[model samples]
Target: MTSTDTSDTSVLDDPVGESLRGRHAPLGRTLGRAAAYAQDVATFSAVPADPTAADWSDLARLLGPGAFADMFSCPALPPAGWEPVFVLEGRQMVWPDGGRPDPEPAATGPDVTELGKADVPEMLDLVALTRPGPFRPRTRELGTYLGVREGGRLVAMAGERLRPAGWTEISAVCVVPELRGRGHAGRLIGALVTRVLARGERPFLHVAEANTKAIALYERLGFASRKEVTFRGYTTP
Candidate 1:
């Protein structure tokens, strides 16, 4: 159900934390001010926007010593012993409120299919080939996923991730390299946007700032950049 007002955008600031505390609570763990998804689901972890030392300690304990923490877009810095892993520049884009576009006709219908547990193998293979983002073995458990197939092989896909209250993040949008330039990514995203809007939640997503092509496609589909984000990962000590 809807956990927050659809127009309230504050929850977008701490999406991972909001998701863990709201819709994704069943798939997450928390200790003090720290929370993380199940090991196989996602590597994301969250703490207060202005985290204290104890918050860092709690997160480290929750993840166990030396575990990797994918702190998606949280600008707070961790304690010294928390070694930096990787950092990437990205931006959060959201569907304009009340702007609903028709789902791409070809993307729906028989060509696009709802993906489930049995499709994980193929999904992983697609992710490996496309390098969309941090997709894990149990990532599909987060929300609905859809894929397009041709020649009886999966060629493209997109799906939801990080449900923060009334917002659903459309993520893992990828296509086989050979199939690039086709409208598969846009069509899959358009279909997902319709699905998210149909459920009364708004659709949002993050894209690496360097990926200009993807950004252009998303903008063309009516998404607007809400904020710039620096995605960071760290090793807990």
Candidate 2:
């Protein structure tokens, strides 16, 4: 589902609007214009069976030149006249099997607990330590973030990103290098997904195209790739 312009004034007249409203009805009629544009915004999902030069041009216009490479999914080789500075391939993993999985049934440890705003500073540190992306100080404010603390230190964390219509993206998933393979990432995701389902919305996530290990983990968790997409960030020249 794609839309070209924002001229569709009425909420009923816009597909993006309809999709967003249908998915996030609980959010009520308070949809912000930024949210609406964000709903319509797509990078790799816009790839047509036979994309044209105009399509690339329009995509460039929508994303601008300063876009991040991880923000978009494009063909291995872009069409002529379209030169992508960088491309990141990722999959939009959807939970075909509804309902959150049982919450691990037991806690990993007393130190492994969910975090709140008070943990933001430590969460940001974990993100930096893991180097997930260009995380800002306020990024944690984007959604409900959960973490596991070991000895009162934040060691692993995961949280939400990109809210397109009914879909809630689970991103910024990272665990301290020392805590790798400890299932902390999974636990955080599981708990967070539980919250998303409780709100009656679906959960989805993205991973770098080259990340086969993470993909396998997600698949094991009942998430399947719906389609390949890209996250591209741009900057004005």
The number of the candidate with the highest lDDT is: 1
Which candidate has the highest TM-score of all? 1
Cα lDDT, all candidates: 0.91, 0.56
lDDT per residue (tens digit) for residues 76-98 in model 2: 33345444455466666776535
List model 1 lDDT by residue over 35-59, tens digit each. Answer: 9999999989999889999999999
- Candidate 2 has an lDDT of 0.56
- How much is 156 displaced in model 1, in angstroms? 0.4
TM-score of each: 0.96, 0.65
Q: Give the 10-residue window scoring lowest on summed lDDT in candidate 1.
A: 102-111
Model 2: runs farther than 4 Å from truth?
Answer: 1-85, 103-107, 111-114
